[model samples]
Target: MIVGMNMENQVLIVEDEDSLSSYLKTELTFENYDVLVAGDGEEAMTEFTEHQDTLGVVLLDWMIPKLNGLEVLRRIRKQTATLPVIFMTARDYVGDKVAGLDNGADDYITKPFEIEELLARLRVIFRHEAQQLQVAPVYEIANLKLDTKSHQVTRDDSHVQLTQREYTLLLYLLQHKEETVTRDELLDNVWGVDFVGQTNIVDVYIRYLRNKVDRDHTPELIHTIRGVGYTLREEE
Candidate 1:
């Protein structure tokens, strides 16, 4: 039974041990956390990329097959600017801990950690994530404005209806205006790791956002970057 509600955010548990991963998954779920499990480093990367949008924290084992937790954490950090990652591994070397944090890990946990300690760390990460998201400024390009706080968008003073996914995509593009945000980046950052849908989903959503926000406007805000990806900026 759960000792308390998991007011902390969703977590992805990346551990190769079948028993430990399953136990963590069950415990976290019962405590009200949304959890995903990946047994290998490659799968962990895939899961983290796919679920990046909704994932608030990651519990990663430092040593694993395929990519290994350190490599996986590095890959995630390369794309995601400020993700909160906790290294839960037996590698307790000070050098290991420094390297992990230097490479983008938020915290480290040694093997045989108590569940309560894990929960406390998770709570800290979740609180930090919440604060960061709250402080991220709203982004705008052309006539489109996206208020990150409200997760709402408006085009030319008119409400442009968009699905939650659509809003996420739009906001991401707006954040990196003028530069092309790649399809793989979108797949990882917006749709997330658990999304098993077609890669073309990005294209479809782009079209939808364009039609709604730019179909009638004299200047378009979203531009298709041909083979690369999409860019959100003022039209030339």
Candidate 2:
């Protein structure tokens, strides 16, 4: 029975492989994260439920005894939809990835991956989740309004649905309104330092925000600064 000492910053690692699990536990502990290990799905479920409130993230392995990772994740989502779960699996097929994602896995990482990358991903997840807890002052630009405490956004009195990442990105833009936020800055602030130049993820998320926040509204709030980055401001 693996028990977690520090509830704060706890991470549940659900991997059946003893060697890998031990290694992860050691590494994560060294990084100051409270680590809990469960060799099988049943143990994973029990530990997760017991420490759900304190758990920052779950590093879940796809293949496990009693219940697979996806099933465990499904159960976890049924309880808390926003809890971050990253699947660590050897499966690299597109179908497998889609299945994990559709079932509420927040991130997917293939096996034999770099420990540094895994740690980085966990940092990003924790950083994003931490932002959600902050008490941000209500922001307004023209007809758009965002209440960080309520975690809601409205444009012209219509509520807009935004993913956690989108909400964070928007909040950052509103905080720095009228300023061109460079891609690097966004990546650092929103996605964390680990995602500095890994593909055009920043651009992709910008499009996502625009589609929901500005696609139907007049006077776009998110503007592309061509060759520089993006800025959120009322039309001139």
Candidate 3:
């Protein structure tokens, strides 16, 4: 078992190969990991939704029955932004790698990788998560409250439904409360360092966030600076 990460948190292995799945499960279990196995893409989603709160990492196979790994990953990102996922794919094509990472995979390993390498990767992921795992009290600006632990946002006690990307963008803004966050900073933090998309992607997401966070709300919190970037501050 890993020492830093909570042992109660499980690693979900989504693999249809019985032999490899069994091998991985045995190895992880021997190391004190709580393991959940899924034979196909659909089952992976079911297990994910059922145990999302307790899941620590997901070892997602690229090719699976019912749905491909990329599709499964897209669905997972739709629900939560913080969950760490590592793709296990036999294919080493550049496009495939880009698709997986672009879809929010924390890391990926080509198939036939050594067990020690996989464990090292897991440790790195756990270390990163440990930095942000501590639950904090809700951040409130005006009537909006965002609970980082529960990943919930509310306005005047009314819950707001935010997509995974939207939630991450909002959370970053709240964490930097009352500060002007530049597009470069937002791209670096929210979109990951390897983001190769158009620079306007930041502007696009800010627009998306404003529609949900400020629209119809009094004391609008998201504001644009003509030449700078954006800030989340309550205004009269």
Best-fitting candidate, scored by TM-score: 2
* Superior candidate under TM-score, 2 versus 3: 2
Candidate 1 lowest-lDDT run of ten: 1-10
lDDT digits (tens) for residues 141-236 of candidate 2: 988998876667899999876644567788899999999989989888876776523536678778877888898898888999989999998873
Ranking by TM-score: 2, 3, 1
lDDT of 3 by residue, 175-200 (tens): 89888888888877765664445567
What C-alpha lDDT, on a 0 to 100 scale, does residue 1 get in candidate 2? 22
Backbone clash pairs for candidate 2 read none
lDDT scores for all predictions?
0.73, 0.81, 0.78
lDDT tens per residue, model 1, 1-236: 10111124779999999999999998889878999999998898888767777777789999899998889987876665345678898976877876875565655778887887777666655653455365658777767787755545778878665544455677778778888888989887765543333677688678777877889985877888889998877864
Q: After superposition, how far is residue 49 of candidate 2 from its true place, in Å?
A: 4.4
Candidate 2, position 33, lDDT? 93
- Model 1 sits at a Cα RMSD from the real structure of 13.7
| Higher-scoring candidate on lDDT, 1 or 3 | 3
Per-candidate TM-scores read: 0.54, 0.70, 0.61
